[model samples]
Structures are given as structure tokens and as C-alpha cells.
Target: MVDASQFEKLTTVAKADGVQQLVVGAVVQHEGKVLLLQRPDDDFMGGIFELPSGKVDPGESLDDALRREVKEESFLDISAIREYIGSFDYESGSGKKSRQFNFSVDVRAAEPIELTEHDAYLWAPLHDDLPVTDAVKDVLQKYRELRAVRRD
Candidate 1:
């Protein structure tokens, strides 16, 4: 379940912390691997891999932003927002201080992952050296710890 209060607390805290922009990322896991998307060399933060994420439009809920972003970037509908994987602050292309709230999510399907915004996609194994930014790497680490605890 999607909890509006939980999402509200996230935004509330971020605002208190003076975060200028809000973004949401999804960790879509399948077959022991998590999804990663490669940016186009010509785009912002190009030639780097990242989570399927996007900016949260004004007045939009964080959970809704996550679902919309995952769908927009990968054409994969989110089935569930499983867990909150914490967040990291960064400077976006527009030089705004942005904080991304990441979550573990389940998609409706695993096939025909049509890419709309990225040049390529990879199903990276959890233990490998992921070529993502430090922020994403940290989120994945927390995700790994959570998965381990759930299995025990």
C-alpha cells in the first residue's frame, strides 16, 4: 500500500531541509537483477547509467511521480511501490539543489521494455560494480540490505 502520509512526510522533511527540487526513482527488480538505463551521450548527465527517475511536478504526489516516471522512461507500468529506499541530494542540470527519493517497486510486466528517454537498458546483477552515480549506488545498497533482511 501506498501511504499518502508517508509520502507527505518525505516532502515535508525535504522542504524543511531546503531542497529546491524533488525527484523520484524506482528500483525495478527481476530475476535477481535490477534495471538500469543508460543516458544518451548528448543529454544531461549523458553516458552514465541511472535509475528510471524523473522530476516531481508541482502539486504531484511523490508516489504518483514515481509511477509516472517509471512508465514514462521505460514504458513499464508499476504494479506496486514495495519499499522506500531512502534518498540522496544532488545538483541537477539546471543547477537546482535536488533530492531524489528512491523506492523498491514491482512492475506489471518484464517484457518488451520499450525505452523512451534512454539509449540503452541493462538488467544489472545486484552484486556487480554498477556504473551508476554514487547516489544511486547508495540507494541500491540500502535496497540490498533490505532484501537480505526480508529473506532471513
Candidate 2:
């Protein structure tokens, strides 16, 4: 479980770093695979694979935003946010300077996926070279590294 006790610290760090928008991303894995979503062809960053992610609502804590975004985008409820892998900076669809905080999470179930914001979803195996943006791929790489260490 993630504690909102880190909320002030995260926001302060973001503010200090001049991040205009804060987004939360989840690396949701079940079995030996992590979940990936394909963006709509007409949407921003279209036709690319990405982790379930979204902007954090004002006043929403990081954990809350991550879980909500995963649920809303992938229809999967996060049971636990296991680790905070790291973050990456990028420009948003509206050109806002954005930073996405990434985490490794576990869903209650990996089935019954209903993608509302994307066209497709997949349970990408960790052993494969994933087809995602450089930033997302880095996050997933870090997640895999962390998970491997934990399991050791």
C-alpha cells in the first residue's frame, strides 16, 4: 500500500522541478506479463503501446490517481502498488510540460478488461522486447529489474 504521506514530498519535488502537469502510470503485471494498452489511431500519441496511465486529478494522491487511472483505462483495480520504479518527462497532448510517476502494481484480476480510452490491450510478456515508447520501455525495464530483485 502507498501512503499519501509522500504526497507533499512528491508535489513539492514536482513543483521544484517545474513540472507543469503530473501524471500517474501503472505497470500492472499478472503471472509473467505486464499490461499494455494501445492508443486510438486518432488520439494523441496514437497507435503506440503504453502502460495504463493518466493525469492526476487535482487534490488526488499519487496512489489514488494511479489506481483510478488503471481502473478507468483498463478496467482493472490495483490491489497493491508494489514499488515506485521512477518517472519520465514528456510533453502532453496540449503541450504541457508533463512528468509521469511510474509504479509497479498488482491488479485484483487480470481479466474482463474493458478499455475506455484505448483501442486494444494486451498482457505483454516480460521476456519479450516490448513495443512502446522509449520512456515507457524504460519504466518497464526498471519494473522488471525491481521485481527480479524482490523475488530473489
Candidate 3:
């Protein structure tokens, strides 16, 4: 288990050092399947699948950034943020130390996902061969575990 106080202190230190980027990701579920987006072939980590995510802007809150990113990438609105899954750190393609804060969100409307950044999309439960980074897989597992606990 994660020590909450130690995690907070580490986060604070990372922020103080200006060596961490705060990125937010969403796990949007419908009909028991989680939404995943396929990156365009030309982008970083291209051709891999990932959640709807982006960096938080300088003046924006995490929730606001998450909502904006989801809309910008998929044209889907987040109706409610159901739970904070957890966070994981990884070095981005550009060698930047990045931390992703993930959450489980509900879509505002049952509309089609109009993809602007990705080439394709999928709705699947957690699996080993999803073509995402290990960090992303960890986040997905965390969400799955959280949901199971809530259902109990």
C-alpha cells in the first residue's frame, strides 16, 4: 500500500524541483468496457493505445484540464468524475519526467467519439496486450481494483 503522507511529500518535492509534469488521464467506461484511443502513426508513442489524456495547463485545475483534454481529443464531455484512480510516473518520449494522475469519469452524452488526435479507438476491459505503456497498464489495474472495491 502507498503511504499517503509520504506520497504527498514526494509530490511536493517533485513540484518544488520543477522536474515533474502533471498530466491527467481519464478512464471512461460504458457497458462494462473502458475506452481506449489509438494514437496516430506520426505522434509520439504512435500506434499505441492510451486513455484520453493531456498535460495540465499552468492556470487550470486538474479536473478542468481533464475535461478540456477529453473534449479536445475525443469530442466527449465528462459528466462526472467518479473516482481518482491513482498516479504513476514515467519518462515521456522527449525525456521529460512526467506523472499521470488518472481518474474514472462518466461521459456526459452517449454520442459517438469524434476523434481528432487518434486514428482509432477501442472499448475493452483490462488486459495484458492492450499496447499501452506499463505505467498506463498500472493505472488501468488501479481503476479496476477501485471499482471492484466499491461494488463489494
Candidate 4:
């Protein structure tokens, strides 16, 4: 559980800098496949494949925000939000300059997730062929690196 005081401190810092966007995503893996979500043609990064994620609410801890976003977007209860994979900056098609924090998470389960903020979802094989945005790719590269080390 996150501390209430820490949340307040984070909220203060976010407000101080006028940070408008801080998003989090899960690099959810099961059976060697990673989860991917697609934005609708009308939305930012439309037609691009990416991990399930969303904006962090004020006073929200990063891990808590990650679990909430994954649950809301993918309908999966996150069992754990693991190591910090990395972060990347990007400008969505809508011109929203945002930063995305990525992590490897374990999911309790997943179904055909309801698409409210996304157009589609898939459990993609973590291979070179999987279509994904550069931001997601950066996160995946880290996942791949960690995976290799574990195999050693």
C-alpha cells in the first residue's frame, strides 16, 4: 500500500511543474505473450498498437495508477506491478506531449476486455513481428533484456 503523505507530496510536485500528462502501462505477459491495445482511428496514436495504459489521477501513486489503468482498459486484475522497465516521451497524434512509465506486471486473469478507451486488444506473441508503437517497443526491449538475463 502507498503512503498517504507520499501521495500528497507527489501531487504537490505534479502541480508545481504543471505536468499535464503522466501515464502508466503494463507489460503484461502470460504464456510468453504480451498484451497489446489499439487506439481507435479517432483517438491519439490511432491505428497504432500499444500497451494498455492511461493518465495518472492527481494524488495517485504510480503503481496504483498502473493497476487501475490496466484493470479499466483490459479488465484484468493485476497481481503485481513489477520492475520499472523504463519511460519514454512522445507526442500523440492529438498533439498531447506525454510521458509513459512502463512496468512488467503479472495479471490474475484476462478476458475479451471491454474497449472504452481503445478500439481493440490482443495477447500478442512477444516476437519481432508484433506491431507496436516506438514507446512500447522501448519498454519491450527492456523486458527482453531482463528475460535474457533470467535465462542465463
Candidate 5:
């Protein structure tokens, strides 16, 4: 668990040193399919397909932020969120000048995605033809790997 002091220190360093810190994102799955959203026209990777995620707010746990972001963006309430699936660092096209940590989470179902937030949404089949961001591809690979192991 990341403590407040640790996060504060990280933030201080980010501002002072202009160094980017960790951000949290979610590769949320519902039913047998995973969720992906189109980045907004003004958003980084805008028009590109990507996982539903956002920056982790200060004093917020990764899981909490994941749930909150998913709910806010997708307009869906998720339960039984699993632990970290994987993380990748990237500079957001949003010009945040920071790195982001994307996590894979499992959910029973999403109520309904709020389309105003995104151009489109999809519940893509596992290992099937679907549009997704590179980051999402990494997370789904892990999801597929886990599922394959379970199948065996």
C-alpha cells in the first residue's frame, strides 16, 4: 500500500525535478469480454482505442482510482476488482509530463458506458479481432495468459 508521505514525496520530486511519477489505469473486463474506449478528440491517443483509465488521484489507492475512473468514464459500477494485472509507462498525449501505470481489473459487469466521455466502447472477445491500444494489448495478453492457465 502506498502511504500518503510516499506519494507526497513523489509529487514533490515530480514538481521539483520535473520527473514523472506513477499513474494508474485499468484494463477492466466484464463477462468474457474486455472493455475498451476511444480516446476523446482532445485526449491523448485521441481516436486510438485504449483501456478505460485515468490518472490516479492523490491519496487514492490504485484499486479505488480504478473503480472510480471506470464508473465515471463508463457509467458502470464494478465489483470484485482483482489485483494488478500489469503496468506500462508512457507519456500521455495529454501533455501531463508524467508516466502512467495501467492495471488490469476484473469486473462482473458494467452498467452502461457514458458515451459522452468517449467516442465509442467495446466488449471485445478474448484473443479475437478487436481494436485496442498497445497498452491494452499488453494487459489483455496477461489476461489471456491467466485464462489459458486456468483452462488447463
Candidate 6:
């Protein structure tokens, strides 16, 4: 079981250096499959698959950002946040260092995803073959671990 306080402490330390961008990724799971969004061919990281994510706008809380990003990217409302999958850092296309905080979430309904920023969407098991970033893979792994523990 992850100690909530410890996780918060780690997040604080991770952000102590000041993050250029704070992003949030939502791992929306339904009926055992995870949701993935595909970037448009003309956009940065084009043709790549990623979670429903976006940078947190100024003055927005992390939870609020997650909710907004998911709605904007997938048009799904997050009903509950299951767990904090964890955080990872990577450089964006503009060479800015960013940290993405991931969370496992449940949507309010099993509504069809309406994509605006992405071109396509997929709902597949975590172990299935998919083109995604290393950071995303790490988040999925953490989510799987947390799920297994919860089952126990």
C-alpha cells in the first residue's frame, strides 16, 4: 500500500526545483481496458499514442486540471480518481522540461470519446501492443501495480 503522506512528500520534492510545466495524464479504465489517444499527423509527436493529458493552467488545481483535460481531450467526465499513479519528467518538443502527474480515473459514464486535439482513440488492455512514450509505459506499469495491490 502506498503511504499517501509519503507520496505527497515525494511530489513536493520533485517539484522543489520548479517545473517548467506541470502536466496531468488521466488513465481512464473501464471494463479492464485503458484509454489511449492518438496525436494528429500534423501535430508535435504526430502519429504517436498518449493518455488524455494536458498542462495545468495557472490557478487551476491538479484535480481540476485532470477533469478539464479529460473533458477537453476525450469529452468524458471523470467521476472518481482511483489512485495517484505517480509522476515522470521529460523534455517537450520545445526543449522545456516538464513533469507529468498521472492518475487512474473512472469516468462518469461510458460515453463515446469525442476527440478534438487527437485524431483517434483506443481502449486496450495495458499489456496490448501500442505505440506510446516511455513515460506513459511507466505510468501504466505503476497503475497495474497499484491495481494488483488493491485486488489483494
Each candidate: RMSD to true structure? Answer: 0.9, 1.1, 4.0, 3.4, 4.2, 2.6
Give a tens-digit lDDT track for model 3, residues 26-135.
99888777888999889998898999999888766677888899999889999887777877777788888888878889998746889988999888856545678788
Which runs of model 5 end up more than 4 angstroms from their true locations? Answer: 1-21, 94-97
Q: Is candidate 4 or candidate 6 better by TM-score?
A: 6
Highest TM-score scorer? 1
The list of candidate 6 runs beyond 4 A from truth reads: 1-14
lDDT of 5 by residue, 1-87 (tens): 234554355446555856454566666776778777887777666787777777777677656676788887887766655545655
Better of 2 and 4 by lDDT: 2
In candidate 4, the residue pairs with backbone N, CA or C atoms under 3 Å apart (3 or more residues apart, or in different chains) clash, namely: none
Candidate 4 residue 35 Cα shift, in angstroms, is 0.7
- Model 1 C-alpha lDDT per residue in residues 57-126, reported as the tens digit of each score: 9999999899999999999999999889999998989999999999999998976799999999999999
Write candidate 6's Cα lDDT for 47-135 as tens digits.
Answer: 99999999888766677888899999999999887778888988887887888888888899867779989989999887776579888
lDDT of each: 0.94, 0.88, 0.80, 0.77, 0.67, 0.84
Task: Write candidate 2's Cα lDDT for 1-152 as tens digits.
Answer: 45666656777899799999999999888889989999999999899999999999988888888989999998888888877888999999999999999888888888999989999989999989998998988888888788788889
In model 3, the runs with Cα more than 4 Å from the true position are: 1-14, 127-129
Against the true structure, candidate 5 reaches a TM-score of: 0.75
In order of appearance, the predictions have TM-scores of 0.97, 0.95, 0.85, 0.82, 0.75, 0.89
Please list all clashing residue pairs in model 1, or write none if there are none.
Answer: none
- Against the hidden true structure, what lDDT does model 6 obtain? 0.84
Best by lDDT: 1
